[model samples]
Target: MDNHDLVALSERRQHQVDGVLTAFFRESHYRAKALGTPYATLWETLERNATGGKRFRPRMVMAAYEALGGEEPERAAYVGAAFELLHTALIVHDDVIDRDFMRRGGLNVSGSYRDIATTAGIPLPVAEHRGMSVAIIAGDLALFNAYRLIDRSGVEGALRTRLHDILDEAMFVSAAGELLDVDFALRQRPPSVDEVVEMERLKTAGYSFEGPLRAGAVLALASAEAEEALAGFGRNIGIAYQIVDDLLGVFGDERDTGKTTVGDLREGKSTVLFAHAVGTPEWAEVSDWFGSPELSVEQAQRIREVLEAAGSRRFAEALARDFANRAWESLTSEALPDAVREEFRPVVASVLGRVR
Candidate 1:
């Protein structure tokens, strides 16, 4: 699809998701009045953050739903919106946990709240504390809101129970993945490939791909065979997304992938690309590139050059394509409907081929 096709696809999917979300907020009353000051600001902040994202996870869910013979576009779209909200909430919390100041080209929850406090003449330290406190609570509230969106969804019965179970378990895995992120960050030694890939699955895949899409599919009472197949497709695609994300972190244009630009290098992110470079003989300066307070921009550029020269970029790119091909294979393997399956190839290609 060209840029026009991409725009149309995005518009159609977003409209469907938003209609459901609007109804959810209206039914739940959003409780905006109950939250005070900075806490209330979080809702506005999350709303601001939610609307502009790529919508890939929800699209993944919708695709899986369509693939499996489910035909209600509105229902599929709303489910996708729920997944988007869940992801937005996760990013809000993650930024605070990482103490990041900027996200998606703006001051994030913590930073915005800090600015609010400072503008009110609060001391810098006190303002910073208030910001962190408010942001944490805001993330918690977003998480609560996520569950409410799913639970109060118009759909009901034992299928809801199954969906709830899958969501709960996926949430645990996401947390476990986050824990590994922190632990690995603290490690002085390089992580093994096995550990790195597992982190990609937990921190990056299951919820981002498997959980949300499956939650939607199960609501349609997707068969056991269909569920397994979709799960495999999501898993491979999710891992591939993470690989591309890691590559972009180090190599993408600063203006395109606004979040985590150079964050990987400064924080020594343990991605597959980095593993390949460090393990290879070509990037002999890999350890020196790990980063230090004194490392200059020039030094960073040279290190990136070393990684590329070692074929880390090529390795990661090939792996991402391989995984995407596998995803297409799973998607078309008699588990999904004809219309959904027809678009699956295009969607996967478009997403995997993104530069940033």
Candidate 2:
């Protein structure tokens, strides 16, 4: 298909998935209402947050399915919605772990609850506790709903079993990565590049890309070679995507990225970009500022300059390009159809954009 035709296919698939999500949320709200819990607002918060995202994971599901020559767009829609729900569940939990009050420039699930408690004149500590409690429960609800959506997608028998196994493994792997992230944050020493790459594989590549692609290919009953090839493609591109994300976190305009450029610096995230500069002489210049919440704009700028001077940013860009190149090469596997290869070709450019 031509680029225009592919874009149209994406739009149609997204529209179908959005419809599924809308109906799913509506039922969830009603179910919450029946429970009559004061936490009915959780559904509303989830719905809003779910609506705000770009639906990229769901799109990946559909795209991968199409590439594999899956003829059932309706079935793809069901699986696509399931992947999106999983993403929503993870993002909610991630924000809670990060203690982030905002996402995409608006109050997150925890933030919404915190605002309610604080407005009611609750003590700061008590309000914060309440926020955490609600966010945890909300995240759990989302997590379970993801399974429910996939189970309800009607991929029966062994195929359903395979899909479930993939989803379960993805969540398990991602959790391990999150644990590593927490461990890294608490460590006195910086992470090595290898550790960073492994963490990215589990945290991002597995779920965000590989899992979705694998699940979609499974639905298409793709051959083992085809499945392996797509997994490699997703893994490489997913790492590149994470690298781009880390770059955006530190350097991109907030207006463009929809996130604070300094949040990652303040959080002391052990991203590949940061890992590349560790132990370098220039890194010593800004080591003290690495995890400080009190990190200033000037300090961040200096750190950015130091990272650049140390060639960390360039190293990260080069690494990302290498991964993107491997992803492109994976598409050359004879197991994948020409249509599938063409459909996924644009992902390379999107993954590794021009570094400023």
Tell me the tens digit of each residue's lDDT in model 1 across 149-226: 666556678876777687777778888988898887788777776688899899869888888768667866788877
Clashes of each: 2, 0
**Residue 143 C-alpha lDDT in model 2:** 84
Query: TM-scores of the models, in the given order?
Result: 0.88, 0.96
- lDDT (tens digit, per residue) of candidate 2 on 237-275: 998888888988998888888889888999888898889
> Candidate 1: where are CA atoms >4 Å away?
1-9, 23-30, 34-39, 123-125, 258-260, 281-286, 293-295, 351-356
| Candidate 2 stretches greater than 4 Å from native | none
- Candidate 2 steric clashes: 0
